[model samples]
Target: MKAAFLVPVLAALWPAPALSDGVAGEFDYYILSLSWQPAWCRTTGDGRDAPECQNGSGRDFVVHGLWPQYERGWPDHCETRERDPSRRDTQAMGDLMAPGLALYQWRKHGRCSGLSAAGYYAALREAAEAVRTPAVFDDLPRDIALPPAVVEDAFIEANPGLTADGITVTCKAEALAEVRICLTRDLEPRACAPDARRDCARSRVLMERIR
Candidate 1:
């Protein structure tokens, strides 16, 4: 009886098996080899017939554009919450970076215009490091075989109801300088400001309060 009790306790105390370095290598290869996609945004309706519902409130998920607005801020010329989803009123977005593109191209040079070969090489090295290290993104039990397709699918599964394409990308042409602005003080209330009102009337980026 004592032996049976001790066995169960020992099993419960046992640590999870360590992941094999070989499996980690395979996952790393796939993650680095996968094709990188440019930033893009999209929207989806509830498939309802109601006209009001069709144009009603919807969520926006930006995969990349927010980095510029988030990491730094919006342009100085325009004082507002540049990437607030509620302000868009029509779409959301996501950007898929190429294998070595993420580190070099993300929020650098005013929005991923292009990175030099040296930058690309450095990004690749960084990608390798991300996989080996353990964190929210790191896959445990390193022996598990991971494919690029599988990783992509898993990302989708993780974010239920939200689509990946909702993220949008910006070109180097816009070339807006980065500056921080609050949604309420800088963006929301500014809607009524003379200049902001003019731009809002024409473009109407933000009209209602964004929750």
Candidate 2:
């Protein structure tokens, strides 16, 4: 009888499990995801009227998300005390990412950063600006196929400190999707986690022209 009574008391005092993956502000590094807009349009963005897909939008690589990562795994939708971003905050990111995407990213990955919405967005902008997209991809007049390593090499060349170990290229439906780069909390280039280093294995992946 006494044991049963103590069980209820201890349960109440034990503290509730976090409602999410892990606490915010507790991550090893960051992954800056730059998505190939045209490839996205050809696949998931098809039939969608998003501005990024409009003709002559000139969007090539755009900010996908800034994710908080662990050494081995990653976290998402983590419980945090920071408030969600406001419409103004989301709109401010439109130059780099769609407003809706900014909001979604904030909820999913940004929340795990433990920064306020404004701070997270600011950090995202800083990270995006730090990466230099290869100029060769600026105006591909037509679709082309190339080894994924070539793309990674181009990025490595453009960004001096970045290397094959620090970045990985991803594909969807045989099309170039995103280039993910790992960085330290201070935003310096770092080697990605082993699991995060999975590069697209296709010898020749399609890269759609800029819309």
Candidate 3:
């Protein structure tokens, strides 16, 4: 799901009472969004450096952004304009996300996170590393057809405690888009919000190969 970013004036429009959890430290949980590199590159027709398109980048599932979410809704652009990640950090995570996305994630979602910029990205790295990718996704076959349920089950089988309810398979047209995984603040698999769950009814979705 696309995260909503509220401007400072507009952000204040929602009262503190309406705001969920501690100012930042205590969001309900986290949404570790794993975007399919091939799907994005193929569908959007543009991405990061030549290495990523050439398959030299080792990452299969790229970090879309680690968003801090409320059970019912979410927040964005929490920090004032003064707050930004250091250049070193921006450079470090540049490849993990596409160009501009690293800084964009920090400015939009990461800053709202009670965690500091370094800590937020560190948590993101840990979360991404901890989840084991199913072999099929690791070396995706071109245009391979599979039900969304099959994709969810593959993740459930590979990761302990993860259930179909906690995994949402997002699609773009007929192409597999992303696997949005639900995680507790402590980074454990938790059931996703009913609204956040996948509602796509296609019988089969195509998994684009990362060539």
Q: Native-vs-model 3 lDDT?
A: 0.66
Candidate 2, residues 98-159: lDDT per residue as tens digits?
67778888887898998999999999888988898899897787999999999999999999
Winner on TM-score (2 vs 3) = 2
User: Across residues 20-128, which tens digit of lDDT does each residue of candidate 1 receive?
Assistant: 1111001100112111111011111123232212322221111121111221122211222222222122111112222222322222211221223333233433332
Indicate the residue-level lDDT of 84 in model 2: 94
Descending-lDDT candidate ranking: 2, 3, 1
Total colliding residue pairs, candidate 1: 8
Put down candidate 3 lDDT per residue, 27-122, tens digits, no spaces: 677778776666655644343333444553434565676777788677777754345777788678754554366777777678777878888888
Indicate which candidate wins on TM-score.
Answer: 2
Off by over 4 Å in 3: 1-22, 46-50, 55-59, 80-82
Candidate 3, backbone clash total: 0
lDDT of each: 0.20, 0.78, 0.66
Off by over 4 Å in 2: 1-20
